[model samples]
Structures are given as C-alpha cells and as structure tokens.
Target: MVNVGLGHAELSSTHSNGRVQEERRNEGVVTSWCIAKPSTDDESLNHNIDYSCRQKGVDCRPIQPGGSCFNPDSIISHASFAMNLFYKSAGKNYWNCHFNGTGLIVTQNPSWGTCKYPA
Candidate 1:
C-alpha cells in the first residue's frame, strides 16, 4: 500500500511467461504533480505556459477565462496549471518536469477547489 495523503492505494502486480517459467512484476503507481517553482519569475512562468500550452496533448482550456481554473487568474496560477498538464501529458519524467529549471515535481497535490492538477 502507498499512502499518498489523498488516500492509500494498493500496489498491484502481474505475472508473465509460460507454465515452464514465470516472472512477476510489481506494477506500483506513484502519484506526483508538476508545478511552476515558487522562485520562478513571472517572465519564466509565462514562458513555461506558452511553451507547454503549445505542445500536443496540453489542454490550455482550463486556464482560459470562464474556465474552472481561470479564477485567481495570475501568471503563477495559470503557469502552474499549464506546466503540470504538459508534464503529465508529455510523460511524467524528470526531464518532462524540467521547464528550463523552473518546474518542480511535488508529491503533494497542488490542486485546489475546481483546479485539479493531473497526476
């Protein structure tokens, strides 16, 4: 079991190979989120949003006006959402979260109210 603060998730596994030989693998899912670093400047954050939003699979609609995450509309808020979406969609990897060194991977969810950061 993994305690992710949000809740506990049971670890799963899989078996492979034929009856003659077998292999087992634990398919544990780790939840994580990416967001703009607190120290990142407005310019950098905006750049991250621009770059991330342009990428495929990154839905920037949530950050648009009248969108669920549009309130509290600020560079930091919007950038965090866009960067996280890009990181999640691009493949949750260390490099994916490295938005010119302005991105951070956090175990704690950055979600709030209707703003849900994907994991």
Candidate 2:
C-alpha cells in the first residue's frame, strides 16, 4: 500500500504482460487511474476545464492559437488536453481528473495528430 498526503502516489501491481492492475486511491477496494480519454463539447464543461487549468497554473501554451494542439478548434479537444495536463502534471489523482465533470479518464491514450496527451 502507498500513502500520499496532498501529493502524488502510484501503487502499481503489474501482470506478466506488463500491464498495471491498479494505480490510484482506494475506495473500499474500487480503484482507478487518471488516464486521459475523449472529452465533451459542453461549453460550461469546457470553460470549467480551461478555468481550472489557468487557476492551477497549468501550461496551456500547447492549446493556444499556434500551439501543438490548436488545430482541433474544438472545446472538447482543448478541454481534453487541459484536463490531462493537470491530471498528469499536477499529480495523477481523483482531484486532478475531476475537472468539474469535463474530464473522461480512460485506459487508452487520446493523443491524435500533433496533439500528444502525456502518459
């Protein structure tokens, strides 16, 4: 068991195939990780995600006009990037993944085209 107080913690148990079985906080045996998935286009949600990033000081340059992930031009896409940035950079945890309901954590990498979602 691993314990982190307002910090990052990754207690991983892997299988023979090098796949992690769990890497997150415990909730009566239910566990989950902060993985980036697809995002939604809800304006309110997107605003929340972007607001969270700016408030948390997450580097949002990549999603700017001439940035790496600006081509998408979609709120969902932008939010996805921002959400993942916080989720991974700020410490992969429920709070980071919880982008006021804009974040959708999944097992697969959501990187596409030139936008790379950090793993």
Candidate 3:
C-alpha cells in the first residue's frame, strides 16, 4: 500500500507476469481501469498523437483526456528554452508535462485536450 497523502492510498498487487495492477481512482472512488477505456474514435486519435510524440523522441504516457510527453530527467530536463518555444508554437493545446501548476489538466474535456491550469 502506498499512501499519497490526505487519506489517498494506492494498493498494488503483482500479477503472474510481474506486472503491477493499478487501481483506478475517481474523486476518491475506486473503479475498474479497463472500464475507462475511451471510445474507438477517441482511442484512434490518441494513438495517432502518441505515435507522433514518440516519433519525436518524446517519452509520453496516455491519459484519459490526451497524452503527456515527458523528458527523462523530468524537472531538470524542463529547463530548455527551445522546448518552451516549441510548445508555444504548438499552440495553447500543447502543455508542459512537468510542473503541476500548468502542464495539462486531463479532466476538462477528456475528449481531446484540457487546460493545465484550472480556472
């Protein structure tokens, strides 16, 4: 069991293949992760985006709304001025996958993209 603070806890169990199963959390409630799979259309779109990011050498993880590209060093790798410029050119939809303050909020649309900073 891993405590995430404020009464939030995550419990993991190993599968036969040595893969860890993660419990899905929704507003503190637990649910089946597979049940949360996106619709076919949305799934394809996300897959395309994920492929694009990967082609650029960006390590990204798929989330409910969209995906997040992260640098290996996380915070340290986020100090690139060129990256900032790239994100700016990528428009308001592109987000920094580092700082929690503003990167990409996954709950707003949950269809295409979401704002990093909630208003």
Give the lDDT of residue 36 in candidate 2: 30
Descending-TM-score candidate ranking: 1, 2, 3
Model 2 scores a C-alpha lDDT of 0.55
TM-score of each: 0.75, 0.59, 0.19
Off by over 4 Å in 1: 1-27
TM-score of 1: 0.75
Candidate 3 lDDT tens digits, 1-119: 32111011112233332223444466994431101112223334333344334444333343222433131222211222122323333442423322222222122211111212111
Q: How many residue pairs of model 2 clash at the backbone?
A: 0
| lDDT values, one for every candidate | 0.70, 0.55, 0.26
Candidate 1, 53-88: lDDT as tens digits: 999999999989999778557777788889889988
Q: Which is superior by lDDT, 2 or 3?
A: 2
* Model 2: per-residue Cα lDDT at residue 9: 14
The count of residue-pair clashes in candidate 3 stands at 0
